[model samples]
Target: MKLHGYFRSSASYRVRIALNLKGLSAEHLSHHLRKGEQRAADYLAINPQGFVPTVQGDGANLTQSLAIIEWLDETHPEPPLLPKEPLRRARVRAFAQVIACDTHPIQNLKILARLRELGLPEEKVTEWAAWANREGLAACEK
Candidate 1:
């Protein structure tokens, strides 16, 4: 297995933590996003989304960290990450999605870049990040 990821990407970090928890061994291939390595034709062909944390498994490539983590937990069942109860599973998934879908997308590099391109002040950018964190935490608490 090979994991294509970027060092500072939170999505990639989450995957790394999952892999460590699962004790799964995979080759790590770092794509320097800061250097625009993800935009290269070869890498783009591998992941048209041009994002990090792509996992190459048996005859399949998984994008999206949450999906990859789910696959890991499903395929490698020891030390289960999700609770067995259906309600508990739903709650856990909802909590994770609060951070994954709600908080992460807004503060992602592309969104931040767009904000900067629009001449938003650094203070606004900081505020945006703080807002995302606050909202994500609140959602998790619920």
Candidate 2:
């Protein structure tokens, strides 16, 4: 099993935590995101989306940290991260997605990088990231 990821990515961190909880082991391969290694041909061939924390195992290549965590829970269910009850499980997934999808992505590296490319000065870019984080947190608080 191989886990290809940028070491500092929160998404990758989440996947690593999940793997540890599940007692699953995988080889870690680093793709330096700040250096744009994820966009390289070889990495893109593995994950066209070029997102970090791709899991190559069990005859499958999985991307998106939440999806990978769900996969790990499904395939190796002994130490289930989600509840068995339907409503509880739904709630759990919903909250997790709220953080992973709604909150994190807004201020994540990709968005920040794009903001930089759009000619925003460093101060504005930093402000944008901070605003995104605060707004996302406020939304989650509701």
Best of the candidates, TM-score? 2
* Regions of candidate 2 where Cα sits further than 4 Å from its true position: 138-142
Per-residue CA lDDT of model 2 for 1-142, tens digit only, reads 8999877898999999999999989999999998889899989998998889899998999899998998998899979999989999998888788778777888878888888998989999899888877877787788
lDDT of each: 0.89, 0.89
Model 1, runs deviating above 4 Å: none
Q: Tens-digit lDDT track for model 1 on 1-142? A: 8999988989999899999998998999999988888879999888898888899988888999999999999899988999999999998898888888989988887787789899999999889988988988886776
TM-score of each: 0.90, 0.92
RMSD of 2: 1.5
Clashing pairs in 1: none
